[model samples]
Target: MRACGLVLCVLLLGGCSTTTDPSYYWQSVSGHLRMVGAARPVDDWVADGRTSEALRAKLRQAQQLRRFAVTELGLPDNNSYTRYADLQRRAAVWNVVAAPDDELKLKQWCFLALGCVGYRGYFDEAQARAFAEQVRHAEPDVEVGVYPVPAYSTLGWTNWMGGDPLLNTFLGYPEGELARLLFHELAHQVVYVRDDTVFNESFATAVERLGGARWQATASEAARAEYARFDERRQQFRALARATRERLQTAYALATRAERLAAKQRAMADFRQRYDALKAQWNGFPGYDPWASQANNALFAAQAAYDELVPGFEALFEREGRDFTRFYDAVRALARLPKDERRAALGSR
Candidate 1:
């Protein structure tokens, strides 16, 4: 799963007066302009003699996935992903997530257009780390984790400025994984609600999983096999993380603070032991090693936003007869409801 940050206010550069922090808004504006400035039409890249053959092939395949997203998945057919950019870096942005040491609820940052979201994203890694330090300083009991984000969505807000371009950060992903990332980002443009990160991300996650499966059904055997290996590890890791979160939540609810803290440490230790067993079963695959090492209340809370409500959205799709258009309509109806009501409707499904 790709962890996506939202740039909801990128187009509102002129509205800086609405933000409490001018420097933050300026960085968002400058960083987005720099990325959009680097992009070129995919056709140009394919025709360029200087382009590597491997890259040309990947760009062409991306265009095919983009078309499939529109014609088959009922996604927005817009300027997004029609071009490409190479950020010359590992990640497009770094996201900072924070939560109280004893709680799973993440600290929320309210933006002018995006309302309140659980994480803050920065284009520069140092800036992100500095902000994390500030968060820790402000609340001594808070746990902060900063992680790289491969891509983000502007939510169709910047279509006039060439929209969101495909970036080098994730262009080399496996075929099935590529399809899932693209589907997930495009789903944001389909239906999004203010201040509901779990609702929005889980809805997108459901789309990615559903669309990725459809894509793999017609993909080459090698691609299918590769995706199977990758997804299997991902599923196992998510299950472990989910169980750890549940156990910690139970621990946090104990009668006394000392008991809760002791229980939390025990749960985390067990989680690491279980993960070690999984790595052995996987023949020493270490893809999730970094995440496991950095496991904390903030990281667990952030991960939950992408997983918690996925089942309900998947169930909604099934109830809508698995029709793409009908499923989207049903989701949009739910999006219009108040947040509490929307959660109830999905929970019932």
Candidate 2:
């Protein structure tokens, strides 16, 4: 049955060819199949003698998190995260994002089901970097960035093929972080607005933040303490990034092209200096060094999709009395609205 489902999924993915490049679709299909093929039932791994005790413990914890997502957070209950795969890779996929040299708006890629999104993803890091190079060569005025993605969601499209299995890429996350990542991905299955990357990502992030806090309340003191340190650094880094993005947006809006370009360079330099000072305060934490060093329009634009409108969604959740189901229903209503209207509604709230 699972094999038949996999075949059907391939056909469906292949048949829905909206992109001009057939190779892209082929890579997408093959990459997904390879990952799915590598996965086995979590129970099997837990019982296997070859499975180390450490991995076995993480797998069991993942199941518990999966259950909490469904029963407590009102996330989808499915085969996702019920199985495990070891990709033996640093990242599950690499994403390429590009933007105009002076603009914070990212280039868009349209697809059959995903509609238009800000970034394109490749299962192979080489392919992703190659594509970014192509974009840079073709458009001299475009800024391109390639980044590693730990995980992505299919929005429950391939549930019949055992859903989206947990991968080694993120299974070892701290307990709160693991819960946050799981809740965030499952939220995609709840409400996805095609073409509105900001809305979709922000909504998922809101769910993760809310669910993470709830999970942490019941977590062991050790787990909670670990997540606290991790989250504190993350929050500080995000703040710095957010401030820089705002400065760049102002620079991008300058009247003349030359003025915009000059302002942008100044803003970027100030951003780096500020980040350096922030890093010094962190006692030598370097987690955000790569991102700060490579900051540009494309990177800032990609980051916006995840950060923009998060506060509004968080507020909406509060307005819904923090009931997950009610909040989701409200978000679904917003998703059904025209993009402009949806943004207006979220903003007004």
Q: For every model in order, what is the number of clashing pairs?
A: 0, 0
What local lDDT score does residue 37 receive in model 2, on the 0 to 100 scale? 96
Best by TM-score: 1
TM-score of 1: 0.97
Q: Model 1's lDDT to the true fold?
A: 0.89
Across 233-318, the per-residue lDDT of candidate 1 in tens digits comes to 99988999999999999999999989988999999999999999999999999878877888899999999999989999999999
Q: What overall lDDT goes with each candidate model?
A: 0.89, 0.83
Model 2: residues >4 Å from true position, as ranges? 1-19
Candidate 2 per-residue lDDT, tens place, 1-349, comes to: 0000011123344345355787787777888888999999999999999999999999999999999999999999988888899999977888888999989889987766567778888888999999999999999999998887777887888888888889998898888888888988889889987778888888888888999989988899999999898888888878887888888889888899999999988888988888888788888888787777778899888887777888888999899999999999999999999999988887832
Error of 2 at 284 (Å): 1.6
* CA displacement after TM-score superposition, residue 100 of candidate 2 (Å): 0.5
Clashing residue pairs found in predicted model 1: none
C-alpha RMSD of candidate 2: 4.3
